[model samples]
Target: MIDLITAGLDWPVVVALLLTSCAASFITAAFGIGGGGVMLAVLASLLPPLAIIPVHGVVQLGSNAGRSVLFLRYMRWELFWPFAIGSVIGVAVGGMTVVQLDPGWLQIAVGAFILWTVFGKTPGIFKRSGPVAGAFSSFLTMFIGGTGPFVAAYVKAQDLERHSHVATQAVLMTLQHGLKSLMFGFLGFAFSEWAGFIAALIVAGFVGTWLGKHMLARINEKRFKLALNAILTVLSLRLIWSGVRLVFGI
Candidate 1:
């Protein structure tokens, strides 16, 4: 079983990643966001640099796909269609121009932007700018591996109900990560070697989502917003710290 699940990685590391996948999915499913960023950080720490983004994208694609399917009824199609269109364009451009530019500064900027958006009033342009948000976030995801906070901030600005917020964000992430995985495949990442490991993560994430769904049903809108903001704040701080570490070798 261990050999089937991993290639060169230690068994302990594989176990850790499986657990992280489950916990991260629970966080996102219950709160509407935060899991992808958390999972990305964990992957970056544990996985090879070349494997991190691609593997994270595949795991997230499965996690988000499950949530989107479970809450399909609440998705905001108007936002989805535009975001989908822009995502295709963004992924295309990103794949063509994908470079190993330092993501440290970008991470810092994204973290700061997320903090401001969560605490202050969002700009009028972002209130209904699905295509713009989708394009920009998708482009970044190709480099960063987790643009969920940015996309979640966009969805949050719409002032959706709890269910709608979670539902819409799930579908948006599903699309974004799906495109990213395909891009990585085209660029020649050997996903087949990681298939068993990835499948284990997806199954763990699904269990987490199922548990989170039950918890989400019991939370009220006001409390959900409070929790969501808190989670975003912590994630933003983590991003900033990670970026700083990368930039200065701290």
Candidate 2:
């Protein structure tokens, strides 16, 4: 992996990757959903398939950790335990069964679900049921890579304050990604093989998150939601397309 990255075949590609990491991290810090999904899509296209999920997990772990630290005080502690428990159960099932599933079909389903939400016709399912929402969303996250928007949609419907919203999402994401990283490790994903690149991406995410913290303070909550929804819609389309290509071998 390092050899491919360092072959000097094209410095522009490296620059683009770094830029994508920064943009995605900043979006994640500010909005809580775009970073991981965007980064995963771009990196999946560039890197080996074996490296995609683990590498994305590590980078997102750093990004969410930074967000959690910056907004620690605003986190809703009451929500953590149930959500964490559900996430653990969900990720375990997802990790164990994910390989048996067709990636293309999974992507299409996820993409369709996201689009349904973006269209504003989906009725609120989690607003009145916190535990159920936490458990199911966390489970879907294990297979989907990033489910922040679903969680955010629930929180929004409940009218959570901006700080609590960001903070709560950060906490949930941190738990999910941490568990994912551990699972990947046990499965022999070879973190050491991409240590240098992963380390660089983490540092880049850290810097992006730091900058995002400042911007988050100044941005209006409504505007942030609008931007997040827009980007997520775009990401959903891209993921769907990628899945189609993979499945059809076109």
Candidate 3:
């Protein structure tokens, strides 16, 4: 039973992963962004190199799916369809032409994109950024893993209410992570090796999302928005630094 739960990992890593999953879930549920990238960074440092992105995809799928289910009432289905359609097309292409890219270059591109999205002041862009953002994110995510910040940046530009923001973003991430997980499975990534750990993470994430809802109610809109932007900025900077180190082989 202990072997099953650890899935070849040490007990300490399993505990750390579970705790991070719960905390990351709370961040996403309460702030509607940042958690996925932060979780990916954490997992990257812990998991086997080849397994990082695919496993992260599955874990995030469960995490975001739980959040979406909890906030189902506020989901914006009308906007979701167009974005999902674009995502399907993008993912299809990604699935066909898949190759392991230079992780450094991928991080560089993602960081630059996130900074641009956060600091850019183009009102007209948000009006139609959904499909474009969806397509871009879905394709990139196939190669580099967590591009949730890109999608979140676009969603932030949409000016959604707090609850709607969390629900809608959760749904969108669910679609992306679901597609990525399917792609990984189809490509012969052995998810069974980590089944016990992933299941535990999902259960923890659900509880975290539930707890986060209570805190979400107390956070005012202004502070919530500020936190979202701040998280994006910090994550963007981290990505850039990681990219630079990898590119320089430092």
Candidate 4:
């Protein structure tokens, strides 16, 4: 069973991926953001180049979907339809181009995006138009694997309290990743071969999310906001450093 679960990799790597899933879910659940970036960085080393994004998409879709369901009562349903429509449009448009970017450039872009999410205000359009925000962010998520910070920034701008913020944002990501994974499958990413591993990871993420939600209930708004910014800053800086090193051939 242990050997089977390892998927031909070392035991440690498999264990790390599981643990990363848990930790990532916890981070995202507690603060309503940051987990996807951590898991994406970790998964890049564990999986082959091609499977990385699609598998990440599946795992994230499950994780976010679970969070959305867990807090479904608080979901602002009015927000869903516009975001969903925009995500579909964005994915269709992005799927047409289908160009692979150099890793360093992508990393730099993601790093810059994270920094913007960390320090930036939600644009006026994002504040006003859910569909526009959805379209743009979903398109961006394709190029850069983690758009949690960006989505969180937009949701925060809606001035939702913590529970609604988390619930609404989870649903938003669930839609984005669902659109993304289907697009990847259409492009022949081979989700089936990795199904078992993906399921295990998603289950782990779900547990972490459950635990994190409990913590979330205890956190006050001010502390939660402070922690969210702090985590985003650290994660963004890490991405920037990684991009710089790769670009410099270090």
Taking all chains together, each candidate's TM-score versus the true structure is 0.96, 0.83, 0.95, 0.90
Better of 2 and 4 by lDDT: 4
Q: Candidate 1: minimum summed lDDT over ten consecutive residues — where?
A: 1-10
Which of candidates 3 and 4 reaches a greater TM-score?
3
Top candidate on TM-score is: 1
Candidate 3 structure quality by residue, lDDT tens digits, 164-207: 99999999999999998898899899999888888998888888
* Model 4 lDDT per residue over 1-250, tens place: 6544665667788889999999999988989888998899899887988778888999999999999988999999898898899889988877776576565766677667657755786567767788887887787777667777767777877888889989999999999999999888888887877887888899999999999999999999999888877877787677678778888998
Cα deviation of 54, candidate 3, in Å: 1.1
The C-alpha stretches of model 2 lying farther than 4 A from their native spots are 1-15, 121-124, 129-144, 244-250
Residue pairs with backbone atoms closer than 3 Å in model 3 (clashes): none
What tens-digit string does per-residue lDDT give for candidate 1 at 1-250?
6766875789899889889999999999999998888788889899989999999999999999999988899988888988998899889888889366688988999899999999888988888788898898998898877889989999999999999999999999999999999989998999998998899999999998988888899999999999999988988888788889899999
Q: For each candidate in the order shown, give its overall lDDT on alpha carbons.
A: 0.90, 0.73, 0.86, 0.84
Clash pairs for candidate 2: none
lDDT of 2 by residue, 9-112 (tens): 25665667788888888887777567877788788788776777777887788778888998899998887887777777777777786456676877777677
TM-score pick, better of 2 and 3: 3
Listing every candidate in turn, what is its Cα RMSD in Å to the true structure after a full C-alpha superposition?
1.3, 3.3, 1.5, 2.2
User: Which runs of model 3 end up more than 4 angstroms from their true locations?
Assistant: none
Name the Cα RMSD for model 1. 1.3
